[model samples]
Target: MTEVFFYHLQKQSLEAVLPGLLEKAIERGWRVVVEAGSRERLEALDAHLWTYREDSFLPHGTAGDAQAALQPILLTTAPDNPYGAAVRFLVDGAPFASAEGYERLVVIFDGNDRDALAAARDAWKRAKAAGHDSTYWQQSERGRWERKA
Candidate 1:
């Protein structure tokens, strides 16, 4: 079964939390696909991932970029996996109907948005119904992710 993790973002924005997770995935030698909710959002994230920090780098690209398939981290709005990534991050309430052939799936949602929260809950229910191994993580007051029952 595919392992699924739901990250409820309350304190920090997705821009803050995503890089760290992507870095970890890279460290594990897992190619990644970050599925955004829209093209504009994907473009914003593509730019942000490149220049999120002055010192560090998280190499990524979109389908429009040349040699996109070779990117270690590919960002897209489509449901298709272009880079053959084993790990996928679903942001902005991007739809995920199945977890087939994925090693892991990460769903990040804004805790403040009612629609996003509803979407997250729906995703959780689908994951559970599909019998995927799922876990939930919520940020603490100190701004650290902690697993919740």
Candidate 2:
């Protein structure tokens, strides 16, 4: 069974929640791969992980073609692209070829707007609908981190 883990980061920076998630993934002996549009952003969280490759750019267009060739199972980020932000890759299945290689899917959002929440909800629904077990971890209005319960 594919276990879906969702983590909602309510704080202003990814710092608040990313470390904990990376730690848990590491504890489980999972290899971590992070992709983001900004090098500075990925660096803020990369310090905690043991092994990570940084791509200051995102997966799109011709660049996206190269990323697909690489075939990374675990994609992590505070996505800046609208498509990435919407978690569209999970649905498209093109840029992200297969789900079989990944053990889990984790998305951490800043939760600044209702649309982001809606996107997260929709992504989870689609993943579940496709029978690819998924979950979301996000921050509540009160400013504490929690998973979808």
Candidate 3:
């Protein structure tokens, strides 16, 4: 069975680990969907990897066509694994809801950001209500990303 490990890491840790992770994923032929706040980080990984800015929206002038522009990128482009495998590395309280669409969701919380932690808790509630087996990890200033599980 294939397993997806969700890593909740700090920006610094992400920067250090991403290149190697991407390379390993490619080498293993594993599908990866990286959700992050920084466009630079995503672009740095590889041009072939699809990058999605969860907060980005189409221009107001194209409000009606916004869904058309965003939906394909958000939903269709990332291929699915029949073996139910995938990982999510969330940063700054992002990527915390309805993980049902994916096999597993790993939430990364920065210990320094109280506000982001609160937001992540709220999102955790929503995910639980939606029936996803989710978990969270805290990244310390010492650069360790620790999780309960």
Candidate 4:
């Protein structure tokens, strides 16, 4: 069964925390796929991943890229995983039909957005009912991620 993780963003924006999570996934030798709700969001994330910090670089590409399979991280609006990534990240309330093939599924939503929070809760319920091992993580006051439930 796939392990599902729900990250509720409160103290920081997605831009502030996503890169670090991607870096950790890379450190674990896991290829990743980040899916956004729209093309604009996917493009924004693609650009952000490249210039998020001055000293670091995350090698990534979009589904339209020719060598997408070579990228450790691939960004897309659709659910296709061209890189055969072990981990899949759904951002901006993007919905994933199933967790099949991926070792882990991560859902990141803004806590400040009532709609996003409601969607996350629904996803959590669905994942639990499907027998997936799930966990909820929230950002603390100091901008640290803490497991909540």
Best by lDDT: 1
For residues 92-122, write the lDDT of model 4, one tens digit per residue.
8798578888899999999999999999999
Model 2 / residue 87 / CA error / Å: 16
Show model 2 residue runs off by greater than 4 Å. 37-40, 47-98, 138-147
Number of the top TM-score candidate: 1
Candidate 3 Cα outliers beyond 4 Å, as residue runs: 1-12, 17-29, 38-41, 44-85, 92-97, 139-145
Query: What is the C-alpha lDDT profile of model 2 across 1-149, one tens digit per residue?
Result: 45555455456455544545555555565554544435454444334232333532222222243453342223434332322221222211112222344566555554665754566666567667668877665566776766665
As a TM-score, model 1 comes out at 0.97
Model 2 scores worst on lDDT over the 10 consecutive residues at 85-94
Model 4 residue 108 lDDT? 94
Residue 42 error, candidate 2, Å: 2.7
Instruction: List where candidate 4 sits over 4 angstroms from the true fold.
Output: none
Q: Local error of candidate 2 at 71, Å? A: 17
Give each model's whole-structure lDDT.
0.92, 0.45, 0.45, 0.91
Any residue pairs clashing in model 4, and if so which? none
Weakest 10 consecutive residues of candidate 3 by summed lDDT: 56-65
